[model samples]
Target chain A: MSRWGRRPQLSFPDVGSIEGPLLEVVDLHTSFRTGRGLVRAVDGVSFNLARGHTLGVVGESGSGKTVLSRSIMGLVPGTNVERSGTVRLSGHDITAMSLDELREVWGMQIALVFQDPMTALNPVVRIGRQITESLRLRAGLDRKAAYETSVALLKSVGIPAPEQRLRNYPHELSGGMRQRVMIAIALACGPKLLLADEPTTGLDVTVQAQILDLLAAQQRERHMGMILVTHDLGVVANRTDDIVVMYAGRVVEQAPTAELFARTRMPYTEALLRSIPRLAEASHTRLRAIPGRPPDLATELKGCRFAPRCPYAQDHCRKEEPPLRAAGQGHLFRCWYPVGSAEGDAALAYNVAARVPAALAFTGIPVRDAALVAPNAVGSA
Target chain B: MLRFIATRLVQLVVICFLISVFAFLLVHLLPGDPTLAILGPNDTPAARAVLLHQLGLNKGLVSQYGTWIMNIFHGNLGASFLTKQTVTNALGVAVPIDLELVVVSQVLALLVAIPMALIAALRPNRLFDRIATTSTFAMLSLPTFVAGPLLVLVFAVTLKWVPATGFDRLSQGLGQNLKSVILPSVALAIGSVTVYYRLLRADLIATLQEDFVTMARSKGLSTRYILMRHVMRPSSFSLLAGAGISIGTLFTGAFVVEVLFQLPGIGYQLVQAIYSRDYLVVQGMALVAAVAFVVVNFGVDFLLTILDPRVRRA
Candidate 1:
């Protein structure tokens, strides 16, 4: 505990080895059969989330990050969806649950907070009613009890004047307030798992930070395992316990948060890190973006999904599919030529060293604490 | 909301007064003298003139219009030129029959159309949706006269289930009257249903794309719940709006159905009045129909405002 300010005591049980993962997505492949052809939105993706931990699924649009979240939530559209493999949430096979059975678990055991809070809410209904609709239906709460609980929910999500706010419509509330309301609704029944699909995607930067902070705090308080799907790598760095880097519908790399950044084995993961605008670096410097758009999911690719985009793709990468191999302890990467091989590691290390001076020359720090604080700053940047 | 009603009321009054003026002038300007119909051709010209003078038609057009307008203001549409019965008394028979016909047909249309639309939208591009679309298109294409006869042949002549022609008041016996009215109501409703189904289908498809539906599914709401709660409620306004806008067409269809079925409704009476060259009866009946169209449409507008808050706020 810190000596200065009081920290909210979180008496969460210590992270353990015996509990087994709360959620395990084993090689899930979900494809939609459209008129044009079969588009594999999520192809052979796999991940695991232990209890009370956060797994950040990070990728650009069309990388199947959002689709992964939806697949887990069992909310993919279209009747002709060809879904194979298992999404075991709390040890239940979600793919086999009937609609009624799914409803029984929806808000009570698992819930989703969608990207756009404004459009995600029903415009015609009152906020209070929308919050209570699931609670009352799933939890069998009476009208009085549901309504009273709804107020408490609004307050829990950090909305001021909960009673008055409940009377307001979705449009009447600000964007930030609407997002808070959405979180409140999702958490009303205290679900064990929360799937936030780009939760702060559309908000202003300031609001996005606040929302992320709130979500982090809430997840810790409730001891809820969260799967945060986002394109912003910076968001995952500070919040998530584990990171899954996906490229073109497949999980290319998975590792602990710090290791994924400090020792990115996959070229896609390396490119993604290089693409982020570091505050410790120079201003007005355009980011090092990954060349070429994501591979078309409709077409059958024989080799690595990222081969066309990967700068280090060998002739073998074009012919063979790279299986996810152990890169380090608790770290895996699906790359024929991993970023830290003898050939790439020397260049990568040299690049990291060269980047330090360039970064220092770029951001002239406001030097109050001297140069001793620079490494901590580098970890953040 | 009060202001909106007040404004609508003011407009209604102005519209009603204009209707009165038009009805009065059109009758006065009509080709045949109403007295000739009232008094048979055997009556002497002098006697006919005296009857006309008594009815105030012998006066100058301006004075005559003023007097007719005054009578209209005092709740008199003038006595029936031929029957000498108060037009109001004649209307008591005409209005209720027509009201029942219109109401019944609308109910039938709504009942049939909403379900057809939902089915079509739920399974779009499938055989059922294709069939419904084709059926509604066929119904829309057929004229009411043709439909009326075809229905009569099938249900009345072939099946021998209902009478082919003629109407009896429900006071005679609810069952008998309903049997008599059913064919005509069905005939009239087919057209309305065709239009309503098309509108509702379009609305349902659009409503399905709304974010609330995605939200509903994400919350694990069943397809049925999502359809009813999210898709149906939001789209119900479009159906009502369509119904409101097409009231004039429905009334016209009602007229054709009434005449075809030999129902003694306002449309039938108006036809008889027009054929007999009974100017007062024709003018009064036409004016009443116009008033009904206006009132029904206004009420529909008000209902739309209530159902869709956006319209009220606008």
Candidate 2:
């Protein structure tokens, strides 16, 4: 309405006063109808992020972590894609909103930082336009205001020479700088929720830490809810308030970040943590890899999705599935023999005595008890 | 950028030289003689031999080419063996019609095809997409020979909207000139519209799947805005290249349309010269058309660099 009258002012209403979590996702399932069959990428995943809190969704490729974030934004749209379930932003049901209605919500109520900054920003457009689009359109800022706010947004994201950077295209900037511009664009409208899907996936280790720290700092400064999706457990270990571990399209375990790391229950989660190279480890320490590939989600899974590779998996785990059940305060896991518990310890010992290959390989007991078992204990392993 | 343009210009000069050589050889290698086409069957051998000597045709092929090319550098294209008219003078009368037809048809084709492509790409495989694609195929299948007469029959014979077959001078009112141009341009443009639409729509659909498009969508940009601002430029690479190729090879399409509608164009001149075996005129027309082809493609290449910054650096 400044100078040239148009549509009325439009932006995410400040819903900071609402009583519940900033965002809630209930039993979201996303599947693609491919030539082979229905590939369920995200299945029955549920989580919540309160105001100013960061929720990390950690999983490997094809585990539906990226799909989960897109689903929350209602970004998955196609004839071949079938998405169902509920996603609420500040108590408004996003899943039920029409695409047109969701358009109003996107970038205003919630914005997403993409996985790869290299391909996220438009190659032909200047960084100024990319960062200030939401400001001018949704926030109804004037041309001058949008430009000024964009410079500030860039500066807030730790970019130097903001004015010069604003005029540059995506290809002009380095990988880390492009990612910073992406973060600036995401935070431009002061969205109530930010979905960052592996924001540092293609960056080097040092740049990865810088981007992660930058996102965390912005999340704190704006007090916006965030869902950080990544495969590396170490990336989210210190940044997130809560963590959700997805395996084969389902949320296998989720808990408050510190609590979950302190008492890791799910074997998949434990294996993911072990894979991260630790500083205290001696040079050339062999990283522990979870022995098998993630199961193909197109097939019907009748038991625990992690059972085939679990070191302590028993008959119960092979035949029956476990729900996401709580063990302690705010800690949830899905396992027949939860990691570090008495039942899990007993199961591990029994497997070692019975000479289970996975159990032997996991515990490093093969070298110690090599004479106790036959030489060829593992086929694939 | 300067170096790139300079390189392309060099390539164009080499291409023009090759095309001239090719045109000259094409006429010279023919079984018939040019003087026979000029002096007629009743002319005596002495008259034809004198004409051949005067024209320098009795010289070796290399010397003949060298003399012809040297004259071209001196701004002479020789003369038609039949009409005794300079090729440049003939081309001056004909080049305008062909250039206007090509320009109008290209403009018309893009004007219609771009919007259609943009719309069809939005919901590909749906009802609107299906209709547009089906119509594109139908238009593509209809050759200029068929489409030209069909347009003439419908627009001229029945509706009397335009002349059935004829050329009009631009000195006549602009409206009168356009009236005659309508049928031939439409006939020439319809085929290219289909080709360009299909190419552009496919590229747009592919670009729409790119991650940056999704990022643009998540920014709350309208579908149309995203399609135009975020999607269209990158998607138009193939379309621009196709346009370049079409403009370069335009004589083939124009030939059919001009003959069908009786328009004065380079293609028509080439056809008539070939029928009479007027070798100098035929070679001159071919050389002119080839130069146009090379220049058009060169401009399009420059445009491609302008549209895609990555291309300039590369």
Candidate 3:
């Protein structure tokens, strides 16, 4: 009955009660039916995020972090994609919602800041029009009001001469500026949840930091739940409240950020943590790369996905897949011998003695340097 | 933008000049002589020589070309060898028909192609997409020559719905003019629609996969709205380029369709001029067609600059 005419109102059942988590995803599975085979992009991932809390989903490329974020947003590409499981926002089931129904949820309740801001914005559209479109459509703001809000949003995102920038196209902006515009568009409607899928992936380091700080600051000011998806652990190290480590389209580990780093359990997470190049380390240090490529999702696997690359891998690890099990308070890991356990230590020691070259190969480093770097790596773990 | 337009205008002029030279030389290179065609073979050598001298055929090729170029600048396209009528006067009568045919067909083709392409792209690999793809291929394979007769048989001969051949000027009743032009226009349009349908469909499929489209989808824009606004514009670049080149083919197609329908268009005149070896008419038509090609391409470049920010900024 408003300006758009006869749109179905998207009213939540209980708007007043805010007891449960703001977002809850349970047993999510998203697969693609490619010509080769069925590729399980996000194989059985589940996590919950509370209001105003930040959750970081970390993984290597092809580990399904992006897919997982998209799956939550119900934006999986292609009709061939097969998705199952519940995506609940504030106790309301959205997994079964039609696109028309989901339209109400998107932009108003949830929004996404995509990776590769270079290509994430429509090149032909003016920046102001792009930002104001959702405002007019979803928020039902008048043209003048939307324009004013768009200018304010751009200004809030730290763009200079917001009035003039509104007229410029995406190609006219720098990469970092484009990313800021993307953030501004995502934040325009003031959604309760913001999914940032590697928001700073292609920005320069200084710009990356600035963009991340801007996002964190905005999230805090708006008190919005955020899911920060990034392959770089350092981006989420101090920013997120909780972290989910994905491997081969599955959640290998999930823990509170401080707890995960202080007492790392999964060997894959430990390897990922070790792989980060620290500035405090002496210059000219060869980075310890995680050996072996991520497993092909099209092919079925019987054991833990990380077993092939784990130095602490045992015969039992090769025989059976490990279920996500609770290791400690607010921490879960998918490993038979969790790190720092007696069995894990004995396994590492035995592997080091029996197959020193194999142990060195696991870290993708020289044998002599492996021993020299092991102490410094384990001390951090 | 002004500088870009100026550069393009300069380039267009250069292209048209080269095309004029080529058309002039190619027409003159024909096996039979225009003078011989005009005068019977039994004509005396003295008479033929006098005619040749008068027509300036005895002059050097360069001198003849220089005179033709100078005449062109003075707005004289020369007189047809057979009819002895000014080529510009004939063109004045014929060019409008060809323009109407081309413009109507292109408009019809776009009206059909854009929607079909969009529907196919939106539900790719589905029944609609499969049907559209197969039909476009079928239409593409069905040459204008064949499609023209088939349409004539169905609409004019079999159904007796409209006239099968001939054209009415727009000075005539608007409705009758449209009715007369519709069959030939449709005949020419079928081939163009097939090309545009395929090009737009392919580009839309690829553009719909772009991250910005995903971003738009994530923004809760309706599928229809996204396809129309965000997906259509960016996906149109390749289609626009293809359409610009297709204008040349449209002319060729128009020649065949015009002859089939006996429409009094430039294409019909062109075919008649070629068969009778009317050198001046052929040269005039060729120059006009070449100019149309260059102008169409120039327009496309300007449109691309406006549509694409990357090109605009560059």
Q: Per-prediction TM-score of chain B?
A: 0.91, 0.96, 0.96
DockQ of each: 0.28, 0.50, 0.67
Tens digits of per-residue lDDT, candidate 1, A151-265, equal 9889888899999998876878899999999999889888889999999997999999989998999999999999999998999999999999988898899999999998889
Once fitted onto the true fold, the runs of candidate 1 whose alpha carbons sit more than 4 angstroms away are: A1-18, A278-289, A340-342, A345-381, B7-69, B80-86, B272-279
Among all windows of 10 consecutive residues in model 1 chain B, the one with the lowest summed lDDT is B244-253
Candidate 2 local lDDT, B1-314, one digit each (tens) = 89898988899899998999999999977888878888899999999999999988999999999999998899899888778899999999888888889888989999999999998888899998999999989999998899888998899999998999887888998999999888898888999999999999999999888889999888877776777778899999999999999987885458988888887689899989999998888888999998888899899999999888778777
Question: Where is model 3 more than 4 Å wrong at Cα?
Answer: A1-6, A13-17, A356-358, A362-381
State in Å the error of residue B103, model 1. Answer: 1.5
lDDT of 1 by residue, B179-289 (tens): 988999888888889989988999898888776777776665557666776678668877887787666445444778888887767878877887787777777787888
**Cα lDDT of all candidates, in order?**
0.79, 0.87, 0.87
Alpha-carbon runs more than 4 Å astray in model 2: A1-12, A365-381, B60-63
Superposed Cα deviation of residue A198, candidate 2 (Å)? 0.6
Model 3 Cα shift for residue A115 (angstroms): 0.9
Taking the tens digit of each residue's C-alpha lDDT, what string does model 2 give over A17-66? 67898888998999999887999999998888899999999998889899
Give the count of colliding residue pairs in each prediction.
0, 0, 0
Q: State what share of the real interface contacts each candidate retains.
A: 0.41, 0.58, 0.73
* lDDT at residue B152 of model 2 (Cα atoms): 86
